[model samples]
Target: MSEHHTLYAAFAERIDAVLSALELEGALPPGTSRANVSVEPPRDPSHGDLATNAAMVLAKPAATNPRSLAEKIVEHLSRDPLIESAQIAGPGFINLRLARSTWTDELAAIAALGGDYGKSAMGEGRRVNIEYVSANPTGPMHMGHCRGAVVGDALASLLEFAGHAVTREYYVNDAGGQVDTLARSVHLRYREALGEDVGAIPDGFYPGAYLVPVGEAAAQEFGDRYRSAPEAEWLPVFRAFAVERMMAIIRADLQLLGIAHDVFSSEAALQAAGKPEAAEAWLRAHDLVYDGVLEAPKGKEPPDDWEATELPLFRSTRFGDDQDRPIRKSDGKWTYFGADLAYHMQKAESADELIDIWGADHAGTVKRIKAAVAALSEGQGEPIPFDVKLVQMVQLLRNGEPAKMSKRSGNFVTIADMVDEVGKDVVRFSMLTRKPEAQMDFDFAKVVEESKDNPVFYVQYAHARIRSILRKGADENFAPSAEHLGLLGEDDLALVKRAAQFPREVEMAARTREPHRIAFYLADLAAELHAFWNLGNADQQKRFIVAQDANLSGARLFLAAQIGQVIRNGLALLGVEAVEEL
Candidate 1:
């Protein structure tokens, strides 16, 4: 009942104690690092309940063969009452089978912990700032941005559950040429709203009909004041209004998928505060920035028109980049890289670690930004940890054909549209069914199917089935009781063992910074639950509610309830709902 108490953690400590005793006995060298030793579930469940490579990893350090070390470790491990058996497998791997009471005790722990079952203290309350879905303020949220958004949001929740202070951030790229185009697009809509015959939307302007509402609002607010004005007179005013409206649309779309960021950092605001100038000055002082000219293009046939122009460049080549990167353009305006460098420098000021979830198209720019962060942070005497995760694009399909574009957004399918067709839970869970960096297809037909092939449906059905059984037991005047848990058999204990893996899976996913692993784990756990449920179909006695045996029924229901709790805990980390009825 202590904080962060888990079955796997307990066994891990036991293994460490055994190793420490060997160190004291001079069986292993003193001060040897045990960092590489790992205790996890074996690949084949039939081998044992828990497997460790302790002997395999420590054999060389102890001046012994793996089999010798394995035998010694097993001799000590066999003495523990909780271990039913300790056997050495191929290549000196030691697998331990736990007493039936161990799984029963873990089930009790799950019930006691409830929603907090899988939470961990691995992060130790470190501050982590995660920036994601920083789509341009020029349009609505689309399928292109969906994958990174879900990945980043789920990772933030996962880290928080692992005991980190997390800040979910969205960077607004408002100070860019794209917003100018958006402003012009809204102007056409504004004129159309005022009964002006604004012909076809120009090729360079945003052609989405979504901007009509923003145009209508502008018309109502200004009342023809900027209708006939020159380009300069109305560009800035309309740009600000359009950017604000676009951000509102983006937020609403994100809300459809159950996503909300804690902070929305503005690129314009960062530039207005002169952070870029400050960053340049600091880099210059450290000789990390110098006046330089870049080489011509890298291909076999370089551009004949390529010319060298002197500009302020970051010494990215010094930090593993292929070449020095320009921070500003020939016109004295800051390039995207320049603004991003300053943005990351500012983020490092408040966070112990920083993470950016970007689309795979941005992969080429990652090295330069990493170099900038390393140079800037190290120059300040404290280097902050930074990670950039690139998520591949999701191709939307309908009946094996490419999905149609949204009339509302004009170019791509909007997130809202996707969520409307298939509910938010389906979209969120589907996005996470695959690794973030691997390309995936969001087939509308396959995702919404109710069959077991759909992972979301399969996982949700497991929780619903358990809830239904509990409800039926309630109607028959039966309640779950832990007092008779000893009556549960091996099949019941196997399910309990699978459920106990939730805490370990949570820590592993958090450590790898991969939330999709949680989805994979949940799918496996659901399969285990379904397999257990099938036992009742084969035999009447294996059913959860036995007509004449209240003690056995109560124990079964107790086990079922804890399994449901574990599923709910896992789904909560992925921000997916655990529906009682699906």
Candidate 2:
């Protein structure tokens, strides 16, 4: 009774119905569940259009051999109108070849849906919060924050396409000690701006000249009022002013890469609201924290002030962490982990699931945070799902040499500088070329190349070639229609099979939370398009536009249009553009 129009889902439903009837007929065994049944495309397309391991997976549970179960399932599958043939393959796998008309109908469906071709309702509008690019508000965004921002944005877009209500969030670390250092650095610049002799930036202070503008602004506003004040008097004022300006620079830098977070949760605001104390009180009520002293740190050198003094610690050992984590330092101030726990507790109130994308350096913090969330959500409605993805570093190379430094950012390569060198689309597409956990080399000369090695260019060229074909038709209303679709041949039908995989790819990418798969899929789809176009070079009859046969040409052109549509949709999810011309 469901109105899901996905082709794979339709076949899955039929397969389930066939299995249920066999169960009711008392042929195999009663209580044989079909929960693990999966009707997906086969590993080898030469064998069949679709394959299922239902028989193989269910045989042990049904108390029968796999071959016997496969034969029974195929007997029922062959009776379906859409199936051309069904055969049992190795180890009781049922391979089915759907009718050619099924492929043709799918082409028509793509035309009807256009850019919305591969969207799915599998998420059922569940609330998911994705936190990414929580760079400290002390400076401009650098290349270090690029990968996480792009991946997190693409993942959020993919989830939304799959019917999830996703919130893209950014956590502001304004309450940390780093911001205090930033404030002191700005004050030094403030004195310099007021015509005072400030020598080289001292140790433990930020050396970047990007804060000069903040200092000039501060000096102009207050005019030496806070310049001679004590650290305590000017610390709060400087922290607020510098952090606000730094965040503005960061937002502008992010906009260059086509990213904007929906929520900017401030740690300082959380402290002001007394959330951290309330969260700790709840943990104490549950006995998840205790006053404990630690032994010498294992597998690492202890800090200089390491002592056995008693301090409040969370019992993370009970939840899988290697050791209990201290929530308060010897100075009686909350540690970073304590604030993080309260932040996550705040997140759980609005999100059904949470995901954080972090740099590779934060690998050690993952376990304790997971434990904190597990302890906090004990009595909540349905424990929230939490995942942390670690994104590896990107080594910048310029023609096999280390890339030159950026002047705009003062210390590191800025996102704005990268965007200026290579356009936003190229930056986004290149960042997703590899898995997030693998270190990648981003070569400036190689990324902008017009060769097949550059996936973004290759995919965009495929779309442009198709657009050129349709524009040559000379009809203002020229669009891919289902009319004359039966004129397609075996070669054309092969292209249709590739197109049919779009819906499957989209659903899989969304379910796995890996939008990089979409990038890989588009590359494969582009290769297929290139191959199909090359077939006409050897045989004029294979050309998409036949001057002597308009009907057949219309059919081929329709297929090309549908392919271009899917490429556009995939690019949209990655926040890239699909150009109409090379």
Candidate 3:
């Protein structure tokens, strides 16, 4: 095991020993496991440094006052060489103050590990699949899809960094009603381009001018032959042409934001092209396929002509869904869920874990989809691990006023449009500064501002400042020899200590499947370095790369260089850029 892991284990053992002693003395309840006990720094540095709730949890069961139990635990804990003091605080919490040497050791560990300081083995080589930006091929991707794309991409990067085998996937919704609308839109444009006055787009048909070029392409390829062709004669050609074009555009937009998928599973191919009869075979084998009539959905109704007809149903309710869902519509065509089920089943062939990133609007659809996968994997060894994360909407603003809907797109703001306004680095980092489930506001005016509130600029400035110091040190013949690292002073040691926590942050984010932790960690580390720098400004002797003291200056420069490496590594996991001299 790594030294950091060993240190944590030792710390955990000490806590367990204290818990055991309390139990043996009849000071606490039996069967209380110390495995969940945690030792972390207190929010207030003056409140005895580190605190634990162990005594508070054991008080009532031990028939003793919490503070009394805390006092006993502290008496037992103060013997450790690493701890300088221990005390009982408010509500019987045990607070600990570690000797300064402990923090100094942490700094040394950071220097030793360099960029690999925070790596963890929590994942144990498990495989995970992350699917995101599964937008339909009907049009260009908009701002609504941007947040999820960034979140999913960064999350996948975080997972991989934490040692999980991750596959990034994009589900293409090309076989459904939406794509048909796109095809029809392109057909109209095609006819329009062929000198036919198609007039304004027909009702139920897409009217966006984006399709005009698609229509023109078709006209140039077929030479007006499709103008008078039957709907069936040209529908396939139109559908193929439009979906391919739309996917191309979507790919370009994702690239603009620095995202690329490892797999692009096409719904159309899953349905009719590859592995024909796959969905039907799996459904029948599981007894999930049946003929039944669904109750008319409440608060909504299909056309009056929509009659209750016997159609294939999937017994989704068996797995906690509210209602059994339809696999085939009344028209004998596969429902969207049918295609989705087949796609997930295909996923099982290559992955052991599956995660889908969706919009909050799909909250109502989570259960049935999970149920289908559960049923498919029922008796085939272990159940496949499936999870869905919903990315909430993004509200944009400029100059404290809500930005008008994207002016050029004439619809929702496109991801490409946002990338054009602000570079990809700012967009990626700012979007991930908050949890994916929380609604976030991205202010165009503030992200580029040169202040602490703008994390992108703050982090980049820290890196640039570090570079300047190193260059100055090099020019003055202050060589950063490994010998200097041992003499790191308090402020320099504290900065390295903070930088060493990057691996831990990566592990936490990946194990919880939350990438926002990386953004928060980088910001906090930057703040720590900035604080250390400000302190130096007041004390000329302590300034980084002090020209008169070569040994001390070289050691501090090494610490700062390590800090820059950590910042770059952390930002890279979030898919954000790290500039050396911004």
Global lDDT of each candidate: 0.93, 0.90, 0.81
Q: Model 1 scores what on Cα lDDT? A: 0.93
Which candidate, 1 or 2, would have the higher TM-score against the true structure? 1
Off by over 4 Å in 1: 298-305
lDDT tens string, model 1, 234-341?
Answer: 999998999999999999999998999999999999999999999999999999999988887889876888788899999998888888999999899999999999
Ten residues in sequence with the least summed lDDT for candidate 3: 1-10
Candidate 3 global CA lDDT score: 0.81
For candidate 2, give the lDDT of residue 312: 85
* TM-score computed on alpha carbons, candidate 1: 0.97
Best by lDDT: 1
Runs in model 2 deviating more than 4 A are 1-4, 298-305, 475-479
**Ranking of all candidate structures by their lDDT, best first:** 1, 2, 3
Tens digit per residue, CA lDDT, model 3, 1-582: 352563444565787788888789877788865554677656775685567887776676677887888888888899988878888878877788767666556656666776566666666778888999999888788888999999999989888777778899999988888888888889889889988899877888876666787788888988888888899999999999999988988999999999999999888778776442566676777788777898775757676776788878889888788888887777777777777887888887788899999999999879998988887766456789899999999998897898877654566778877899889999999988888889888899998999998988898888888888888888888866556566777667667557656766776788788998888899999999889889888998778877788888877887787788888888888787788686
Off by over 4 Å in 3: 1-10, 13-33, 48-105, 108-112, 191-203, 216-227, 273-289, 299-306, 404-408, 479-490
- Measured with C-alpha atoms, the lDDT of residue 513 in candidate 3 is 89
